[model samples]
Target: MNHGQTAPEDRARPLSVVLAGGGTAGHISPMIAIADAVRRSRPDARITMVGTPSGMETRLVPAAGYALETIDRVPMPRRLSADLAKLPGRFSRAVRQAAEIIRAAEADVVVGVGGYVCTPMYAAARRLRVPIVIHEANARPGLANRVGRALGGSVAVAFASTPLGGADHVGMPMRREISQLDRAGRRAEARAALGADPQERLIVVTGGSSGAASINRAVAEFASSGRAAEAGVRLIHITGRGKEVLDPAGSPLSAPGYAQRDYVDGMETAYAAADLLVARSGAGTVSELAATGTPAVLVPLPHGNGEQALNAHDLVSAGGAILVPDDEFTADFLAQTVAPLARDEDRLAEMSRAALTSGVRDADEQMAARVIAAAEAGRGEGRSRA
Candidate 1:
């Protein structure tokens, strides 16, 4: 609870929440969704974000209208090359800075998502006696979240298949915009808002929030070739603010049948507009696609033991979507895979059902309520003013 603020339920106290984690949208998006959920239940809950300056969260968190406190930190390299000499010093500074940030937030609870920076971030919160919670988005635990669980209230997760070691499954926190799609008879209007053509199969492409260079390259190549245009597909591509150019002016895919934006403002409408979706298999994307029942072709990031591949395979094995490895991606393959699927109304319908089956629609509310319960339960104590 924040100083002298009372909870509406009992007029007793108001809670403050501190979220620690984010390097990618996969990590940061969930935190934002959870914060929104927390706000809905307890409007008085104050929220702040703590993140390493090295990642996109530094830009994204502030962009979402939240203040970001920066700490100098990086994740441990997966391989131990000789350059690890900087680890100890950097880790020490990050912990100290993170601890200071916690003290400043006057936070009642600290939530850790993903990323190596989480180690020091949660360490500060734990040592400061703030209630801690971890939200794990993957079906499998990341090494950081696995270790951080000891310091958490419960491991909130997106997928039912995730291994959380007896932790409660609070589902993935989806952006509130997605839950709006649950309203009756909004699909066609939502689709029209994104400017879908009445005669063509609407296809939306995203390379994750920061943009997938490989996916972007592939889509740009495909879009430039006029193949998508020939196939009568309307395209909406999110560039994630990395590249300035999407295609040449005279390119075949550069026609009025397409709209390209660096950042997506109406993601819900994009989902509503898309019949066949092409995207990265980030947990947040996977959950969003599932919730919106949008059929997708998932291209997992090929590096790092196939984390994204594993996620895509989970959906594929359950008949939700197709998994195309990055190495297998090309302009021709993308056109052949996406174009036909877009035209096949029955396939789109089936895939949408499969995707819906994979969704945890109420994840945000479940996670928020759980975290708030813990925060309330732990609120008998207060932070030391020292």
Candidate 2:
């Protein structure tokens, strides 16, 4: 199907699209999903993504067969430290560099998917009079997108009801891999791959890559304390890089029966194995949690204005998950607070149903339509203005 401007007059053809921003899979994965949607909707639309040389996007983008243009733009400092000292000079140089990339790409529009690197790019796009838009994945805004949104012509958000009520509400986009799973199939797979105990409940603890020290400590303590076992729950922990009591090897817990790993690439399997998921409430994590229809206990990173907490709050309020304050996210509190839910099958089912109900299954495709529509509308507005 050919993508076109949804205007009353002539419906114009699709235009070239450029997606800029990446660091985490939260950012990179959504951008990629959006690109894929654009390609399917408008076959003639050429797409490119801007990524740093070292970020995961560098490998992910090329592997997906999309050309990546690298730019050396550093993130602006959030706190008043020595790093903040370089802001003025660094931003000045970044603006010029990003402007050059926009000119060379001859892009129709630039979209920033939250990150520090997008600062210079968006700044330059503003200066050059190019149409700019951005997608803020967090319930709380980031250092970059807060500034970028102030200057952008349009803004889209994951959780619309948050404090950032001004930007347009476009739900969180998810990768197709996570989107394809149905609850029945994933449950069976999760049971098999993780060796979940049928008589005992299962709790899956994952702290993304590099691991959350607090989450690891709390989960380990719970497993060791026998509280986890008392709940008739076996723990399956995904430690990004954190070392458990069994530090040398990545092993699941054995004291009360735990299965641990440094990392888990097969997320579909992990989600299926979990009766409850405990982890950081990152945008990607939230999207995947909703996609799989699994109940979660989210602890937002207590740093940086506590954006992760805000993200979690949005989901929790919707009845999909629970938000635990990172500082108070102790093993004692967890075993005491969360363990009770395991026995309450009714609440668990309610959470599972809520998680599935609120999910935006076709977020990528929906967002692609918005972006393409924006570009076409911008062109129309320009013509009218002229």
Best-fitting candidate, measured by TM-score?
Answer: 2
Q: Which segments of model 2 are wrong by more than 4 Å?
A: 1-14, 77-89, 197-200, 242-244, 247-253, 378-386
TM-score for candidate 1: 0.83
Clashing pairs in 2: 252-258, 252-259, 252-260, 253-258
After TM-score superposition, the amount by which residue 326's alpha carbon in candidate 2 deviates from its true location, in angstroms, is 3.1
Model 2 agreement with the true structure over 178-213: per-residue lDDT tens digits: 777776666766677676765567788888877888
Q: Per-residue lDDT of 59-116 in model 1, one digit per residue for the tens?
A: 8898888888878766686577764887787778888888888777767778888876
Q: Each prediction's TM-score against the native? A: 0.83, 0.85
Least lDDT summed over 10 consecutive residues: which range in candidate 2? Answer: 1-10
Please give the range of 10 consecutive residues that has the lowest summed lDDT in model 1: 244-253
Candidate 1 lDDT score at position 379: 62
Instruction: Report the CA-based lDDT of candidate 1 relative to the real structure.
Output: 0.75
